[model samples]
Every structure is written in C-alpha cells, then in structure tokens.
Target: MVGLRVLTCGFAAAALSVAGCSATGTTGTTPSGRQATTSNPAPGSPSTASPADLARKQASAAYVGMWRDVAEAAKTSDWRSPILSRHATGDALSVISRSMYADHRNGLVAKGAPKTYPKAISADPSAGPTTVMISDCGDSTNWLKYRKDTGELADDTPGGRRAITAEVKKAAGGWKVARFAVEAVGSC
Candidate 1:
C-alpha cells in the first residue's frame, strides 16, 4: 500500500507540471499525458496572402509608376511622353490613371506656335482610352507647348505656375486615362 501511494504522488506531480507548461502555450504534455505539442510548425502553417491584398498592392504600384511618368514628362517638356499614357487591367487597372492633363503652353513653343510669355494653362482630365480631347483655344493658339510659364512674366517675371491633375480608371486589358485637369498656382 505505501509503495503504491508513492508511485501515485510521483505521477500526479509530473502531470501537474506538464499542465502548467501547456497553459503557457509551451510544448508540453497532452491531457492524456502521453504526448506533447511540439515547436515544429505543422504543414502549411504559414498562410498565403489573399488575392485582394495582392491586387491592391498592384494598383498602388501602377499609380506610382504613372505618377513618375507624368513628372518625367513635365521635366522633359514632352506632352507625348509614354509615361503619361500607361494603363492596366483587372486589379492592376485600379493602379493606372485613366485621364491626365498637361499644360499646353510649352507644347505650343515646341510646335512653333506664337503666344505671349504667359498663356492660358488648361487641363484635360477627361480623356479616356477611347476618347481624346483637343485644345479649344482656336487654331491661332498653339497646342504643342503646355503653358509651362506662369503669369509671373508680367513685371519681368513669369506668371502663376500651372499643375496637372489626372483621373484614372481600370480597363479591360490594362488601365486607361479617364480625366485630366490643369490648375494655375501662384505667380512664377
């Protein structure tokens, strides 16, 4: 009888210790006290990211790429630069811009169109892949050079600088330009 009591106490103590470890989420004995959870990860323990998340990321990337293109076009004074016309489709489509506007003031200069130092800067945020908008200031006005000079040239300085705003949309195959606008900002 005494030997049996000693054996029972030893087994109970060991079981209690394992229970404590399990409560702390450590690898420890199972309730039956025959097995313990292990540190080794189960098969496919790490789940894959969802498709929606991937699409959103792609959209963000496309938008950034398009913005870079627009900035590059501005620096180079080229309205026809390819960067301004990127498009994407599906989830990626949301990332590309559909419409964009350029200040035609400088484009006019490139085309040898005559104009005052400061010109009426305009935007074209409405042009999509299937639709294109042309300058409306009549044939006498130049459409080549987007109005890069602000109205600041008046007192021997340039006029207000202009900025372009774009609207983007996803398309069937890729992305499309949806809208464009030009805003005049401060005197140059």
Candidate 2:
C-alpha cells in the first residue's frame, strides 16, 4: 500500500504538471533565441513552424531546462520554491513538479552519486501538439544521507543511477512539465 501510494503520488504529480501546460494553452520561452523552423514555405518567405512542431520545441526546451535545474534543487529540499516564486503556472509547474518527484526518488538512495557523476538527458524535438513533450532518459551519480542509531549523521555512498523520462508542454508563460517517469538503474 505504501508503495502504491508512492507510485500514485508520483503519477499524480506528473499529471498535474502536464495539466498546467495543457490548460493555459501556452508555451514557455524567452523571446530572445530563435528556433529553426521545420518546413520551408517559399524561397523568399520566412520559414514558419507548424503548430505541432512548435509544441514539441516548447516541451523539449521546458523539460530539458528543468532537468538541468533538478540536480541543483536536490541540494536543497525546497528546489521547487524558486520555480513557484517565478509564477510558473502551467508548463513550468509541471516540469518542476515532475522533477521534484524524480529527485525524491534519488534522495531515497543511501550513498551519494559517484565521484564522477554521469549526467545526460536527451530531447527528441520530433514529437507531439502545439506543445512538445520530450523524454529525458539518463543516469547520474547520487548520494543519500541518513541517520543511524548512533545519533550521528551517516551517509550512504551508493552510486545510484537513474533512467528518467519527462514530458514538457508550451504555456503562455513558457514551457512546463506534462509528465515525468523515472526508474533507478543498476545496483546502488
């Protein structure tokens, strides 16, 4: 039952994150960088993005960007605080929420990430709607801290690895999370 609850909570968190982006009908992005357009329209015309392509880009950017932040946030239990303060409603909230879920799983580990942490997340810009949802599958070195009966702080040196997937969406504010799933890889 406890395991079910944990899984349910994780999925619920993913769903909520996705909903934020879907509800607002927005995509998150700074107006500065220009993304490459897919289909070429005319010789002299500016190439424009199809709704589908735009969605994928939005989700990919949001999801990938969030993953980068997750590692940093794990250092502080309140990683989502900065995201919330930014008023990250739709896609942004989804991304962060999903990341928090993933991070929590890592926190359960005993040992920390390997000294040479392997971190990598992939974004496939070739999938989904007016907002794209990318999958981030990768591994990392993580550390887990716990207290023993001795009343002193003890740390587990498990080099936990992970395979994580995230779905992002486009929101009015920017990109946000649509879904997130993660599985610990190998032995700790």
Candidate 3:
C-alpha cells in the first residue's frame, strides 16, 4: 500500500511536469549550453521544423500523453488499458501498470489530472536526435487516490509540486516515454 501511494502520487507529479515542459514552448538550454527551443511550424507552412525541434516536440507530447493515459486508467484502476502502451514503453509502462494493478487490488482509484510543465533539457546528437531528456516541475495538487467503495480519500498525504525527469526515445511507432522518475512532494 505504501508503494502504491508512491506510484500513484509520483506518476501524477511526473505527468504534470511533462505537460508543463511541452506546453509552455519555452526555450531550454542543453547540456552543452546550446540554446534549444521547442516550437512548431506556424499554420500549414512548409514545415520548417528542424529534426531536433521535431524530436523535442514529439518527445514532450509523448511524455505528457503518458500521464493522460495513466490518469484515465487510474480512474477505474484498470492496469490493462490499451491506451497505456500508446505513449509509454519499457519501465515507464511497467511502473504505471503495476501501480494500477495494485490500486485495483486495494480498491482504490485516482481522480483528477496532474499538471505538467516539461522542457526538453537535452537531445542526443544535435542533428537528427533519437532521444530526448525532459525536466519538469509537476503539480499533483488536485490528483489523488480515493477508495472506490466509499468514495473517500485513501491516503493522508496531499499531492503537491515535485521534480520529475524523463527519457523519451524514438520507437518503431513513435516517440515514447522510456522511463521517468518522480521526486517526493515539494521537491520542485
């Protein structure tokens, strides 16, 4: 049960972080001090987005999407939701599944969605990147677990802001969150 709380709360923080990172369109500095920007082509222009830019955008989207999928599954404690695989893979997927399974067994369900602010911190290879590192300050203030049978809060700990990091890799389908780590509450 303690592990389940950590997983549920931790994932909410991670999701918030990823969403914030991707949605702000803020410029980030890479490990080498290079200025990296995440922006998309205006309208339907010639699509002048660089490979690095595209990778960052896609990776950020996947990270944010993973959180959304997890939130959806958490509502019903459904670990086997097919949507989980759409944006997550590897350990990222495994952790979410395990968390949801535990929630199901314990008769707990999560409500609300997390808010993420994710930024592309780094990309492997300046040109034509295949992996992107994301840093985020996720807020899980409103996302929390509840007892399904009684509709009551399950944990005493309230969610809050936390720091999160994720590695998104290019997969056969598309960019996917390969792994992520969420710190304890107030970590941000």
TM-score per candidate, in order?
0.31, 0.45, 0.77
Tell how far residue 47 is off in model 3, in angstroms. Answer: 2.3
Q: Candidate 3: global Cα-lDDT?
A: 0.77
* lDDT of each candidate versus the true structure: 0.29, 0.39, 0.77
Worst 10 residues of 1 by lDDT: 11-20
Which run of 10 residues does model 2 get worst, by summed lDDT?
A: 1-10
Model 3, position 3: C-alpha lDDT score: 26
Candidate 3 worst ten-residue window by lDDT: 13-22
Q: Report the number of the highest-lDDT candidate.
A: 3
Model 3 Cα shift for residue 152 (angstroms): 0.7
- Candidate 2 has a TM-score of 0.45
Q: Which stretches of candidate 2 lie over 4 Å from their true place?
A: 1-49, 84-128, 142-161, 186-188
The order by descending lDDT is: 3, 2, 1
RMSD to the hidden true structure, all candidates: 27.9, 12.6, 10.8
Q: Rank the candidates by TM-score, best first.
A: 3, 2, 1
- Candidate achieving higher TM-score, 1 or 3: 3
TM-score of 3: 0.77
Ranked by TM-score, the better of candidates 1 and 2 is: 2
